[model samples]
Target: MKVLVAVATRHGATREIAESVAAALGTALTDAGVRSQVEVRDAGLVHSVEGLDAVVLGSAVYLGHWLEPARKLAESFADELGRVPVWLFSSGPVGEQKRPAEEPVVVEDLVRRLNARGHRLFGGRIDRRTLEFPERAVVAALRVADADNRDWPTIRAWGREIGTSLARLERSVS
Candidate 1:
């Protein structure tokens, strides 16, 4: 099995999430006795999805919006992506309090355009030291503390689900 995990991240939090998902997915596929090759790449750097059995695409959400690179990737590869099993995820919404209840505005449209099998929303991390002007100012204004709010268990479970799906798919085809 061949899988691609393409992600667009700002300050690398979303990338970390992508890595975790990739790791878990790889482990699960191994446990299922399905030999697999999974590549995690920057969404902007990927030019094609040829021969990929599945794809997991994700982006970092900022102010209810997905970063431009990810959106462009989906738009650029819509036709090719639609032919395979694709999953989507968004990483953002950080706080000591409850995570945001709203999904990124563009998620639904991309999911439909790509015929994505599912979408997940994962909590994000904020490190004040990494922030630039407006973001730092905004964090200061909102008094949002620097923290990593991502839930590993849920993220891993989601990855395992995709792995399970792929194993079933492989069996059906064989």
Candidate 2:
């Protein structure tokens, strides 16, 4: 099986999350003795999904919306993606809440368009030092707090679930 893990990030936080998810998926699939190829890419750079068996796509959420590149990827590849299993994730939410301030506005539409198997909302990271001037202003204006709330164990478990499902899919096809 071949899997593509794609992400859209701002300030590299969501990229790290995507990497972690990819790594976890690779490990889980390998440990299960499942034969597979996994590749991680920036959403904007992935132009085709021709040979992939499954896809896991994620994006940074800002002001309750996915970043444009991630959204555009789903829009552009909806037909191809619908032919395979796809999972979506959103990363952005800080502070004690440890959940998104709101669901990303694009998720529902993408889920339907892509025929996505599942979607997850993961807590995000915020660093004032990395913020551009306008981002900083928005953060300050919104009183957003700084924190890294990504749950590694949960992420790993989700990856394992995907690995298991793919293994079953491979079996059924074989």
Candidate 3:
């Protein structure tokens, strides 16, 4: 399968998460001994998803909402996405607050309406040193501590599951 992992990010945290997801997927496919392709791109710039067997769309949340470009990509590709398999993820929750879902989230709901197979939430990062003056003040006022919350093992597991699911889908279609 050819999988595209498209994500929108700010402060580069989300991009790092997206890259991890893509790498995990690539490793999974290789381990499965399957001939597959995986690529990562910024959701805002992906003009086409043609010939892809699966797509994973994700975004970084800001103020409890996904970035505009990520939402735009999902909305614009809704029709094409419905015809194939899709997964959705978000990199947002910080610190110990980041946990896997036991219920549906808003972005996941949107993904479901677009026919996505699953939606996931991954922990994000916050670097106090990298924040601008205004951003720094906001974090301080909000009492947000600086940390990298990404979980590599969890990400890899999710990718393996996606690869397994897509492989099964391919088998069924064939």
lDDT of 2 by residue, 1-174 (tens): 799999999899888878888888877778778878888899999899999999999999887899888998988988999999999999976767876667788898898889999999999898999999999999888887788988888877887788888877877888
Best by lDDT: 1
User: Which RMSD values do the candidates have, in order?
Assistant: 1.0, 1.1, 2.1
Clashes of 2: 0
TM-score of 2: 0.95
Error of 2 at 123 (Å): 0.3
Off by over 4 Å in 2: none
- How high is each candidate's TM-score? 0.96, 0.95, 0.90
lDDT rank, highest first?
1, 2, 3
| Candidate 3: segments with Cα more than 4 A from true spot | 96-105
lDDT of 3: 0.81
Worst 10 residues of 3 by lDDT: 96-105
lDDT of each: 0.92, 0.88, 0.81
Instruction: Please report the TM-score between candidate 3 and the true structure.
Output: 0.90
